[model samples]
Target: MRADARENYEHLLAAAHEAIAEHGAEASLRDIARRAGVGLGTLYRHFPTREALLEVLLRTRLDQLTQNAGELETGSPPGAALVSWFLQAVAFVRTYNGVVALMAAAIEDPESALHASCETVRSAGTRLLVRAQAEGTARADIDGTDLFALIGALGWVGDQPTFSPRAGRLADLVLGAILTPGEG
Candidate 1:
């Protein structure tokens, strides 16, 4: 990309990040363009769709989570690493309101732009889960799919206006259940 085009791309991403942070993941693209001082066409030319834009916005954070999962898997005890990474995954899903739902859908839809990102995040969690199971720290019956669904449930609870404060406690409960007697 040319210098000016690159600047516009950066600005648009910054503006969209702020807009999503303030207005949830489904924030208006037009408003994001306006905030970025760019035309709607420019935003479309760069992102093409809301999902596309969101995929880009979430890529960096998801990548970080994947890397963090790898580090934690090697640096900590199996159960401790899984718990720590599970908490981080919860926080990652809470980056924008309603993102958890989108990610959940994306994980099952191969055509979705965010599918790869979702898969990467899931794979990281799965690795931690497998490690825990192998070490007899986490329940063998509870697979990565179960853990992913649990995270989504936690995210949904956190999204609710009245029940948001209890999300953390709920996550802790889930994690506690996943761990064996001497692991948590």
Candidate 2:
């Protein structure tokens, strides 16, 4: 990309991040372009679709989360690692308002722009869950898909005005149900 175009891309991403943080996944694309001081055409040239833009915005963080899972798997006990990774995943899902629904859908749709990154994150979480189950520290009935759904559910709870305050407690309760007694 040319220097000027790259600059515009960066600005658009920054603006989109702010907009999504404020107005959620449904934030207006036109408003994002206006905030970036770019034309709508420019924004489209850079990101052809809303999901495309969101995929770019979230890909780096998703990669980091996947890496964190690997590190936790090696550095901590299976149960502890799964617990820590689960908390982090929930936090990531709540980063941009109203993103939980997008992520849940993306995980199921292979054609979605966010699918690859979401899959990578899910696979990482699966490894952690499997390790914990192997150690008899997590429930055998639940699998990676269940873990992903739990993260989405917790994130959705965090997004609610009435339930946001209780998100931490809710997360603990959910995790308690997933982890075996006397485990993490």
Candidate 3:
């Protein structure tokens, strides 16, 4: 791509990121293009669909969470590491309005653009869960996919417009159930 075209692409991505952060995954593409001083066609040329744009916007965060899982594996006790990573996953899934729902769908739909990102997140959580289980810190019956589902559920709770303060308590409750006695 030419330097100017590359610059336009970067600008559109930046604007889309900010718009999505503020308005959520359903934020208007046209608004994003306007914010970036680009035409809607430019945004579409760079990101053919809403899911494609969302994938790019959220890819860095998904990678960060994956990297954090690796760090937590060795940096903390197994139980503590798993708990920390679970909290981060909760945050990641709740990054935007309806994101938890989007992730839930993505996990089930192989054709979804966000499916790979969801898989990466689940793999990271799975590693933490397996380590914790091996160390007798987490419940043996629960697997990574289950944990991912729970994280999405927690994120859904957090995303409620009514703003329930019970979100934290709910997280604690789920964590308590997942962890073995006297762990987490």
Candidate 4:
């Protein structure tokens, strides 16, 4: 991508995250474009559909989270890494809100960008979860499937207009409890 195009793409990601965090599922693409300092045409050029844009924006956060595995491998304790990843997941759930419903449907149906992103999560997230479990920190019984289910279930909590402020603390409490004591 050209410099300007790259900037636009980054802006779109930032705008989408902010808008979704503040406005939930009701966030508008037009407003996202305006916040990005880009025209709707440019957002269209980068992401042709609102769904596509939301998918990318959500995946962008997930991708960052996926990278945490690498960073965690550097020296972070297994428990800390697991907690960090879960915290990031909660923030991601907050930003995307109810968007995972679309992703869940897409990944189950057939070939789609959603499936591609799911594969990404499976590969990296599995590794991270395994690492935590190896240390007996994460619950041995809960696998990637369970984690995904939990994240999806919790996304709705973050989507609620009244639930926003309490989400971070609630996520911490919920995820901490899910982890096997030390894992949290």
Best by lDDT: 2
Q: Which tens-of-lDDT digit does each residue in 95-114 have in candidate 4?
A: 65667676667657655666
* Cα lDDT of model 2 by residue, 27-125, tens digit: 999999999999999999999999999999999889999999999999999999999999999888888888899998998899999999999999999
Report the lDDT tens digits of candidate 3 across residue range 1-184: 9998999989988998788778877899999999999999988998999998888878888889999999999899999999999999887766676788788899899999889988998999999999999999999998999999999899888778665478888899999999999987
**Model 4 poorest 10 in a row by lDDT:** 88-97
* Cα lDDT computed for each candidate against the true fold: 0.91, 0.95, 0.89, 0.74
Quote each prediction's TM-score: 0.96, 0.96, 0.93, 0.77
Rate residue 127 of model 2 by lDDT: 99
Q: Candidate 4: what lDDT?
A: 0.74
The better candidate by lDDT, 3 or 4, is 3
lDDT of 4 at 138: 81
Once fitted onto the true fold, the runs of candidate 2 whose alpha carbons sit more than 4 angstroms away are none
lDDT of 1: 0.91
